[model samples]
Target: MTGEELGRDEENTAVAGPVDADGSAEIGELIGRLSGDDDLDRETRGRLLGRLARLLGQSARKAGAAGVARGKWLTDLLVAAAPHIPIRDLETLRAHHHGLIGEELADSVVRVASNGTTAVGAAGGALAAVEFVAPPLLLTAPAQLAAETLVIAAIEVKMIAELHAVYQVRVDGTGTARGAAFLTSWARQRGVNPLESGSLTSALGSAAKSALRKRLLKTLGRSMSTMGPFLTGAAAGAALNRAATKKLAEHVRKDLRGGADPIKPLPGGYPSVGPADKP
Candidate 1:
């Protein structure tokens, strides 16, 4: 084949190749890095953390303007983005975490996820505070907070999915199907239903939608406190995010645990457990 033709064919193959391969690998790498021991120096960690926070802020801005999470906007936004979220399956997760299993695996997931959400909040808050100094930036605070809120939601949703995997709560479907299920769980701030039909239709009932909207508004309002001037806003933002993430992890863990006995670690740090409801 001619050079140009060969190059064109290669480009087409690249474009048609499995997109999730790269995306899934990236998500796995991100989770692995975050869940690993804190080895980076303080300055390096701070820089990385800040960059993540800024990225979350950017994501939040794309979801909505004026920080209003009402009606169908939040729901629609999530549904549209659900297919793009990179969700690793159980085997993939096990590989990423060095075969850690049961409660230890679960703990690492929650810790890293919480750190991410808190970083988003602190970064968004700091940016918002800076706006107070520059009047023009004042107009941007709501958007920044909005971005932070969405980004935090995404992180928590991914955590919920991985936690389900940790507990061996098998969710059946394509990656997008599983993502929608967990995305719904994230919106409701609740645990996934193992018996759920794995269909998007049944997930977004009127009542659930209403509750989701209310919850989003409440979260956004709390984020507003992070808009205070300077250091005050930054401190409040970080604390709020940290506490919120911790609370979310607790609630999700409780639901996932489902009154079952604590997961006992097996040989090689993997847990030999299944969902409590499973026979």
Candidate 2:
């Protein structure tokens, strides 16, 4: 090559090396900006940390539940068939309910159940596993489950209200009357029964709310650094319940071929009788 061409090529090579180094440095800086630092402002750090924590908790819960569901398919199968393999007492139920809902709401339900001398109950011990899992996400299985249950409950109430519309039942009192009216109307439109819907709503609502409170109290008992355990446990439990429920519903739908679909709405708002209702 000519001298001038060779010189130009050498200069070009020298310029390219620094440009490559500069590009690498810029990429490193961008990564640093994305990650931020411990010394970042409290609000910014907290928000980032919280988001990371929640993401981790959700992932963990989903994984854990899937593992548990595979191992205990038989137990889940039994629970789906009978809907009452593991019976829980009032206090135990209270705790589960708290986890599903929140403290105050669960407490209210407990008080109401106690006053009427009516015992509230739930099906399957899968939720117990959930209580054991979620803690990292600042939630319990019951708390997460409560949201699902509320969706179920609202559907039940709507069904009952619709039923009342069909029967021409004028329910105009307080408490039970109101509940009955709502439930009746809810069931009719939903093509279910008020009593059945009411039962599921009561059971799920009670369990989720109780579980939530227990988690909060446990978190409060620990120091800030140790709070991760509570949040992790809660997230784990919620994830476990979701997976277990899905598995159980699938098994039920496959094995139990009745008019009742465990994953779908029952004739009323009862615990999803078919696969369609599985969370």
Candidate 3:
């Protein structure tokens, strides 16, 4: 090969090397950005999903129809990425909600998270695990909507963590400790009770792993709607996510209290989702 041609090849290799070498970190960053934002516009959201799709494409063109705990891969990634998920503090929550506090603050947090999840679903984002299941054509969907599942989980985890802060439900530990505790709470679909065994671990226990896998599968089920025609997918995915988020928030808010009263969906069920979370 001529020197110029070889030099161009070298330049291209240099550019692509980082992505190939550090895909996991990159994916974690993407998850953080997508989940942390309450106002990710559609174009930006689509671009980010495209990046995620390309990265997942590198691992393998096909995904294994792995047996029970088919969510194992997703769970593993989430545990590793938990520490990196962006969780706002109580001050941020109060600021974001216009000084709302107590049950009012709690209510707004749930609404924001529910709306964020809805934005992810309606963004016309990644085709998700479709690359793993069906023909490799059109948008790249994670195998069984793996991408959406992870992003949605991150949003929920962040919200749950923030909720603890809102209620002054102090989970004593380092950041990683708190992240892990909150992650476990997300997997269990409950709140982290500070008084109970500390609830802090850097890794998932086998039981927690099981619960996470189950949780992931449940989220994945909702994502299946995205496989339908475009509008149908977006609408169904949004509605399902909004409803699920509100339900999970109910469980968590109750879990966070002393003699916590049982919580249920708003009398008529969740309010309709907006184009994005307000502000």
Candidate 4:
């Protein structure tokens, strides 16, 4: 099927179930907005998160009925949502982080994202004990975990993109190209080295998409480990998420610190968008 036809089907399958809250936005769109939104206060963020949890529950049930978890479905939603994630350019990054440069700026973004994802895990895990007592809530437990998975993924993707900017290793291309590169970076938990061959492909080709789907599945498995009695899920989820984020940050930061400087088209010319499409 063509991209349009496939997307249409995915959209139908994605939104097949009941409305989670007042709005009609899909899971990925919500995640795109929630990722690294500096303006959102805790209360507003909490409300949006509730909506996301309910939506994930609905989507999970619907997809489960159809067949597998639709890993492709989740991957497509996130790729489409990537460009919409609010990432600060270097100037904005410095201003927001109080003129932080180099490692300082990278550290601030990593810490904030790690803390935020840890809190997301805790909130999702808080329902673990009740899930066993209530059948309805039990069904939602996996959904909650799925929601946490996607949100954490979004935050990490945002962090990866921002860290590149902080390190002066710009991935030059259209918004879509850049988004795919960053998404791939997050999927592999590695920094983008523009000098590498096909480092910033126009999109996630078949091999790249498969790798991303697998990574996402692994992270979801980590979320599943949080389900336990006696309210242990919360603690487990928080610790796992914090550690994962920190580890990813360390890996990406190391690669960026050693990678080539800002990307410049070589004589052979790497892939690039036309001038009109430049952001």
Specify the highest-TM-score model's number: 4
Clashes of each: 1, 76, 6, 0
Instruction: Flag regions of model 1 displaced more than 4 Å.
Output: 1-71, 174-176, 196-203, 260-279
* lDDT, candidate 3, 99-130, per-residue tens: 89899989888888999988878764334333
Q: What alpha-carbon RMSD in Å does predicted model 3 have with respect to the real structure?
A: 12.7
Quality of model 1 by C-alpha lDDT: 0.55
**TM-score for every candidate vs. truth?**
0.66, 0.20, 0.77, 0.78
**Worst ten-residue run, lDDT, model 3?**
1-10
CA error at residue 265 for candidate 4, angstroms: 16
Predicted structure with the largest lDDT when compared to the true one: 4
lDDT tens digits, residues 1-279, model 4? 100111122123231233344333566567866776456655566567668878766655665644337477566556655544667777877877888998888899898888878877776666565667687667676666667778888889888888888887766654556666676677777776665544333456666677678888888898885686646887888899999999999888888888523332223322332322233
| Superposition error at 215 for model 3 (Å) | 0.6
Candidate 3 segments exceeding 4 Å error: 1-22, 60-69, 124-139, 198-200, 259-279
Task: List ranges where model 2 is wrong by over 4 Å.
Answer: 1-135, 138-140, 174-176, 180-279
Clashes of 4: 0
- Ranking of all predicted structures according to TM-score, beginning with the best and ending with the worst: 4, 3, 1, 2
Cα lDDT tens digits for candidate 2, 1-279: 100100012222111123233233332222122222113443443333233333334433554656423323211111111111111223434354454333343333333322211100011122223344554523643322222222222222222232232233233222222332232222222222222232222112223223323432332222121222334433443344333333322332232223342222334322321112211
Q: lDDT, candidate 4, residue 120?
A: 70
